[model samples]
Target: MTAASPRIPSPLLLGVGLMLVAFNLRPALTTVGPLLAAIRMGTGLGTTGAAVLTMLPVLFLGIASVLGPRVSRWIGPDRGILLASAVVAAGLSLRALGGLVPLFAGACVAALGIGLAGVLIPGLVKREFPGQAGLMTGLYTMTLCLGAAAGAGLTVPLQDLFGGSWALALAAWALPAVLGTLAWAPFARPSRAPVAARSEVTRPVVWRSPLAWQVTGFMGLQSSLAYIMFGWVPLILHDRGLSAVDAGFVAALMSVGQAPAALLVPTFAARLRDQRGAALAIIGLTLATYLLVVFGPLWLVVPATLGHGFGLGGCFGLGLTIIVLRVRDAAGAAALSAMAQGVGYTIASLGPLGFGLAHEIGGGWVLPSTLFCALSLGAAAFSLGAGRNRQV
Candidate 1:
C-alpha cells in the first residue's frame, strides 16, 4: 500500500503565516527613507553617510541571498523560515537602540533576514501550495505592498506619538516582526525527512539555463526600477514643489495602489499561455509613470502615483510567478528563486545609486527619466523571453 502524504498545515494557518512573513520583508528598509532626514539631523551624519545607511541593507540583501539554500540545508525549509523571522525581529530590535553603529548594523541584519526569507518563500509556496501558486503569490505580494504602505504612512505619526523621536518610530516596526514570528511558531518545525530526501535527489541545473537567466534579468531590471522609485520618486515630487507631507503622501499612495494590482495581476498571468500581454501591460503602465513624473500636472499627481504603483506591483507579482512557472519542481523552484534574487538584487542595487549620480550630473530629472524608460523597455524585452510557456 502507498504511504499517506505527510500532513500539511491547515490552509488558513499556512496563508496567514506566509503573509505575516511577507509583511515584514520590506518594512525594515522602506521605513528608513521617511526618517532619513530626521536620522541625519539626530545623528549628525553627512549626506554621504546617510546615503550609505540607506543603501547598505540592499547591498547585503543581494549578497546574502546566495546563502538561502545553505541555510535551508542546515535547518529544513520550515524551520529555516522560522529562523529568518527571528532574525528579522532581532535585527529590527537592534536598530531600536540609539546609535549610528547600531542603526547601520540593524539594517544589515534585518536585510539579511529579509533576503534569505525572500529566497525561501517562493520554494515554500511551490512545495506547500502547489496548485495555487498564482493565487498564493498574489496574496503574499499584496500583503507586501500593504506592509510597505503602512510603514511609510505610519512611521511619522508613530514618531509624533512617541514625542517626535524617530528612534522610537523605527523601533516600533519591530513589533510586527515579533508578531509574525510568534504566529509562525506553530508551523515552524523542520521539513519532514521524506520530502527533504526527495528534494536532494531532484535538484535542477538552474545556473546553466538561458530561460532562467531571462527570468533573472527580468527580476533584476524590474527591481532596479522599483528601488529607484523607493529612493527618489518622493524627493522628485518634493523638488517639483510639493510639500514634504504631500510628497510623502503621493509616495504612500503609489505604494497603496500596488496592493490591488499585485492581487490581480498574477491571477491573469497564470491563465495566459504566455505572459507577453501581461508584460506589455507592465511596460505601458511604467512608461506612463515616467511621463507623469516628468511632465504631469499637479492635480494629476495622485492618479499618476496610483498608476505607477499599480504597474510596479503587477510587474513584481508577475516576476515571482514566472519564477515558479518556469521551474518543474520544488528543487528547481528553490534554486531558481535563490539564483534570481541573489544575482537579481545585486544588479538592482545599482539603480538608485546610478540614477542619483545621473540626476546630479545632468542637473535635472529629464535625463534620469529617459534612462529609466530605456531600462523599462529592456525589462519588457527580457520579459518576452522569460514569459514564454516553457520550463527551465
Candidate 2:
C-alpha cells in the first residue's frame, strides 16, 4: 500500500478563518442597538414592547444551536461555518431590504446563521488545534467580542455612509457579512473526520451531570446580564441625561472591554484549579457596577463603566471557556458548547424583557435597578455552584 502524503496546516490560514467566523457572529444581533433609534421610528416600537423584536435574534441563538451539531455531522465543522456565514449574509440582506415584519424576521434569520456557525467554530478550534485549545479559543473569542464592539460602534456611521436611510443602514451590514462569508470559502471541502464518522454516542450522562447544569446556569445568567447591557445600557445612560450618542459610547465601551477579558480569561481558567475566585470577583464587580450605573452618583460613571466593561468580558469568555474545559474530549466539548450556549442564550433573552417590565411597572430606574440587583445576586449564587472543580 502506498503511504499517505504528509499534510500541511497553515496557522495563518486557520487564524484568518477563525477571525472571519468570529466577525460574522455578532453583527446580526448587536448591530440593531446602534440603529435602535431608526428601528424604533420605523417600526413604532416602545422599549418594553421592543423586547420581542430585540429578543428574537438572541432567542433564536438557541434555535440555531439546535441545528449546529446536525450540520457539523453532515458537512463537518469547517464547512459548516461556511454555510452559516452564507446564511448570515442572506439574513443580513433580508434584514436590509425588508420592512417591519421583514426586519424582525430577518433578525431571527440572521441569528440562525450566527447560531449554527457559533457552535461549529468552537468545535473547529478544538478539532484543528487539539493541542492549543485554550490559546485558540481565547484568540477566537476575542475576535468575536471585537466584532460585537465594531458592530455596535459603527452602525450609525455605516448607516450615514449611505444617506442615512434606516433600510440602507440596516442593509449596509450585509456587505461585511458577504465579505466574511466569502473569506471563509477555503477549507470547505470537508474535514477528514466528520462527527458522525465516529460511533453513535448518547450522552445521557451529560444530561445527568450536575456540573452540566452549573455550566448551563452560569452561561444563562451571565448572558442575561450581558444582554441587558447590550439592550438597555444606552437607554439607561440616556435616562441619566446623556445623549443617545454618549450612551452608545458607554455601551460600546462595555462591549469593547469584553475583548481583553476574552483574551485573558481562558488563560486564567486554564491555570486555576477551580474558577470560583474568578467567578466571584467578576460577579461582585458586575453587581457593584450595575449599582453605580443605575443608582450611584454621577461622578461614579467612569469607574462603573470600567467595572461593567471588565465584568462583561470576563463573564462572557470564562463562561464559554468553562464549557470547553469542563468536558472530557472534543465530542464532549462540542456537546457541552451546544448545550450551554443553546439554553444559555435562550434564557439570557429574558433579561431585556424583565428590565423593560421593571421600568414599566415602577415608573423609574429604582425598580429596574433593584430587579437587576436581584438577578445579579441569583447569578452569583449559580456561579458559586458552577465554579467548583468538576467535570461537565
Candidate 3:
C-alpha cells in the first residue's frame, strides 16, 4: 500500500498563520518612514544614519535569501519557518531592549527574520497548498499588504499613545510576533530525517541565461522603485506642503490601495500563458503615478496614489508568481529565488540612496519623479521580456 501523504495544516489555520506571518513582514521597513521625525529627533540620527536603518533590513533580507536553503536543510521547512518566526520575535524585541545601536541591530535581525521567512513562504504555498498555489499566494500577499498598511498607519498614533516614545511604539509589535509564533507551534517541529551527503553540498551550476537575469532584474528594478516610495515618499510629500499626518495618510493609503490588486492579480497571472500582460498593466499604472507626482493637478493625488498602491501591490504577487512559473520545480525555483532576491535586494537598496542624492543635487522631488518614471518605463520593457514561456 502507498504511504499516506503528510497532512498539511487546516486551510483556515494555515491562512490565519500566514496572515500573522505576513503582518510581521513590513513593520521593520515601513514603520520608520512614518515615524522618521520621531526617530530622527529621539535618536539624534542624521539623515544618512536614518537611511541606513531603512536600507539595512532590506539588504539583510537579500542576505537571508542566500542563507535560507541551507537553513531549510538543517530544519525541515515547517520547523525552519517556526525558527524564523522566533527570530522575528527576538529581532523585534531587540529594539525594545536597548538604545540606538541596538535599534539598528534589531533592524538587521528583523530583516534577516523577514528575509528568510519571506523566501520560504512561497515554497510553503507550493508544498502545503499545491493545488491552491494561486489562491494561497494571493491571500498571503494581501495580508502582507494589510500588515504593511497597519505598520505605516499605526506607528505615529502609537507613538502618541505611549507618550511620544518611538521605542514603545516599535516594541508594541512584539505582541503579534509572540502570537504568530504560538499559533504556528505545531508545524514548528521538524518531521523528516536529514539527508546525509558524502561531501559538502556544492553550489549547483547556474544556467547563465539572459532570461534568468531578466527575471531577477525585474525583481531588482521593481523593488528599487518600491523602497524609494517606502523610505521617502511620505517625507517628499510633506515637503510639498502636506501636513505630516496627511503625508502618512497618503503613504498608508498607497499601501492599502494595493490590497485589491494584490488579491486579484495573482489569480489572473497564474492563469496566463506568461506574466507579461499583468506586469505591463502594473508598470503602466506606475508610469501614471509618476505623471501625477510630477505634474498632475492637486486633486489627482488620491487617484495617483491609488494606482501606485494597486500596481506595486500587484507587482509583488506577480513577481513571486513569475519565479514559481518560470522554474521547472521546487529546487530550481528556490535557487532562482535566492539569486533574484540577493541581487534584486542589493540593487533595490540603491533606491533610497539615489533618492537622497538626487534630492540633494536637484533640491526637490521633481527630478526624482522624472528619474523614477524612466525606471518604470524600463521595468515595463523588461517585464515584457521576462514574462516569456521559456525557462529563465
Q: Estimated TM-score per prediction? A: 0.93, 0.93, 0.91
Worst lDDT window (10 residues) for model 3?
194-203
Positional deviation of 60 in candidate 2, in angstroms? Answer: 0.2
Among these predictions, the greatest lDDT belongs to 1
Query: What is each predicted model's overall lDDT from 0 to 1?
Result: 0.82, 0.76, 0.76
Stretches of candidate 1 off by over 4 Å are: 1-7, 44-47, 194-204
- Per-residue lDDT for 327-359 in model 1, tens only? 877767888888889989888877776676677
**Which stretches in model 2 have alpha-carbon errors above 4 Å?**
1-8, 194-201
Ranking under lDDT, best-scoring first? 1, 2, 3
- Candidate 3 C-alpha lDDT tens digits along 1-392: 98775665677887787777787787777777877766777778877776676677778888988787788777766776787888887888887765788788988898888778877777667666676777778888888888778877788788889887788788788778878888787666554433223212122533376777787789878877778788887787677677767777888888898788878998788888888988998888877885685467768887788788888888888888877777655555666677777777887777776776676668777777777877777777779878888674
- Model 3 earns a TM-score of 0.91
User: What tens-digit string does per-residue lDDT give for candidate 2 at 1-392?
Assistant: 98664354587887886688787788666777766766788678876666666777778888888777788788777788888888888888886675787788788888898888878876677667777777777787788878877777777777678777676777677888888888888767666654534522235666677788788889888888887777777677777887656666666777777788788987787678888888888888888888888788978775687678778878877787787778656667777778877888888878777877887788788887777788777777777877788776
Per-structure clash totals for the candidates: 0, 0, 0
How does model 2 score by TM-score?
A: 0.93
